[model samples]
Target: MYNLKFLLLAIFLYSSCKANISITSIDSLISVTDDQLYENNVDYITQNAEKILKFSELNNYEKGKLYGNFFLGVTARMHGDNENMVRYTFAAEKLAKEYDDKYVLAFIFLQKATIYKEAGLYNSALNFINQGLTVSNSIQQYEKRNCAKGKLLVYKAICMSYLNPEWKQILRINLEAMKLLEKAGKPFGYDYNYLNVASTYETLGELDKAEFFYRKSLKVSTGNLKGMGYCNLAHLAFLHGRFEDATNYANTSLDYQENNSNKRYRDIAEIYQLLTKIYTETGNTAAAKKSEKLFEYYHNKENYTNELFKKKLLIQLLAKAELNQKDFEMEVSKKSRNLLVFSVISMVLIICLGMIYMKQVKSNRKTIEKNNEQLSELSQQINNSFSEVLELAKSDDPAFIPRFKEVYPVFYQNLLSRYPDLTIAQIRFCCLLRLNFSTKEVAHYHRLTIKGVQTRKTRLRKQLNIPSDADLNLWMMNLG
Candidate 1:
């Protein structure tokens, strides 16, 4: 069901919120099988979530609603839908904070840390994981606290592994996690810990140790973890120069992965890369090329770009939140006399600025109108010049480049100064891009396909080191 209230709540929470919550739906979510959670049965999860939310609302069970949002967030995460995952996670955070349940808070915090870690904000991820650890320490249940602590240690190690490639340190942390898991007698869901330790040893150039743990993980794990174990063994086999064994292990990994809905992209990428190397070493150029293409395809298909953007924005928000709290504390520390004096001074400045602004606005308005008239004429002349050059380009006239330079000397000079070796075709594309032409318009103007224009823009962006999210046209305009 389409839920207007839930949608609105999600929006409001993203903006910011507070609410107490119940955990009824959390139990239901926990009881669900991994297959059911990961299968492409979107309608099943959506309907289940809606029912849980509706029941919670009707019964005034805030905990259930909170858990429903968290469940939805996890489901969205599985689907690689970061936007909805963020929304649902934010909603859950609000309720968890309001409820003041240490266990729930710890769990929610761990989920957020994982989300941020996946998004590539290692610093922000580590901060939240520490918060989870602190809260988990306060939990009354020994097994629950131990399990949460263990998971958090693994999460922290994962983030650190990214920030620094010191495999031994990461392995030490994972070992601690493993100890906690063993102490809790709940090591069933944590085969990834072993895989991580093995991968770290592989990174540290300890193939025998890596193989030992990989086999251990395989013995203890099933599904995606088992698939990942096979993937690692394949990579290890290739490293050991056993091409046939590598091929066998890689195929086994793919078979398991193909049968399961849960994804492990790194494992898939590694498998393809290993296969490519194997084929190359075994003198199968055709198979090697195919595997190399597959490797690139999987690597590019990983949702790293958007996730990194989200993480960057989220870290900024977290910094702003901390700054706000510091400002509040400073405000609370101020004396009444200082506050009164500051307020009076601010009011006086505002009134003075208001009168000055009124006179300046009147003067600037007439100046702006005159400037607008001149700008319109200049813009028309520039457009006409561009059109002439474009027509010349269509005819393959050698004079087109010089004529374009004569018309837009500043822009051309700026581009030339920055990129002296830019091709004539690249220069033409830049002119269109600077004029803020859409992809379709640029394609039509150049008599090329849309994909060709897009490819040009992509290549140019990389050449210029422009960020994916940046406005290329605005950036080009500013260059001049």
Candidate 2:
């Protein structure tokens, strides 16, 4: 019994180890879908992605499930399976957000933009492209960030071409995308960029520039891209009335399309339509009818496919409306929080300024009070000196002149300095005037008649060079 138990325990341990290894291997396998997509192996990607999805579900591997759903959505888009593409893409988006995987989220945004572009919803396409760019910019890896941004910019240019009629702006956006891709060494969509720039040049009626970009597109293109290049060249030739060149170019486009594994029906229809126009213009009635029939056949098929896409789009739009509503609510909440924060900061700043202003006002009030007190004390001291000088002059004391000179030293010095020839009595007369005494009081203090005082004042005015209209007493008080 002990031996049997030991054998069962060993078997269980080995099984557990095998299961862990299998889960790890699935993680690595799911990562290769990106490479498969870049190589244009859509069929292989679909098969491998579906198997990854199954194993991930069985093992409950979240990251594996995310990549599997994303790549499947990419394949679904290539196959024109709009419904499944939307379903898978949204599923991957939900998982990516849960994992906080910015790289996968950026790609998902691009896929959404592409879906909207294919459905002719240019406004919505632009919205997703901008969102993808925002996420791409947040990526820490330089090459990955630039590569992701480059792809989004290409899509943005395509969407803008439909929504905006400004060809120059569209060309600028296309060139910016090419520059970013070149810097990253990715060259993700050079063919698309060249084709778009060529188309823009054609729209601007610059035939030479348009032909140069078309040739550039053909040089870097393969498969359907090469076919598209020939078709656009054919259309350009037709527009310029080169019937033979248009016919040859259109036939070459058709030949390339015939061998393209991933043929674009709309492009094929455009080539046939161009051929029909060429044959009709060149007077080849039989060939014109044949080309017209082929054009109608492919055009009808393209329309049917578009109709199916529109139907699927209607269903997706309903779901998208709900998602948009949620996004709007979150944005509103974010703005509310920001407003609350701003209000609090503003309140704090206002309070600080108010406190500073109040402190300055109090300081100024204290300084003004101190200055007023000092001025009042100085004025009282000057009044006391004036009283003492007047008392001595009123009593006719012998020391009155000397006392007056001490009380008003500057006035005494200015009078003596300007008039050294003045007598002692004249100097005493000036001292009484400097005290602001009335004419009668000055005559009384000097023991002379008012007329004698007036005569002394006239002589003093002449000695001082005072103006005729000036008051002598006033001038003496203001002398220094």
Clashing pairs in 1: 21-62, 21-63, 22-62, 22-63, 22-64
Candidate 2: list runs displaced more than 4 Å. Answer: 1-16, 258-263, 319-480
Q: Candidate 1's residue-wise lDDT over 235-292, tens digit each?
A: 8888888888999999999888767775656667778888888998999999999989
Q: lDDT score, residue 272, model 1?
A: 88
For candidate 1, give the lDDT of residue 295: 83
Candidate 1: segments with Cα more than 4 A from true spot? 1-49, 262-266, 303-480
Top-TM-score candidate index: 2
lDDT of 2 by residue, 378-435 (tens): 3444455557668988887776776566556678898888789989977877777877
Q: Cα miss at 117, model 2 (Å)? A: 2.6
lDDT of each: 0.73, 0.79
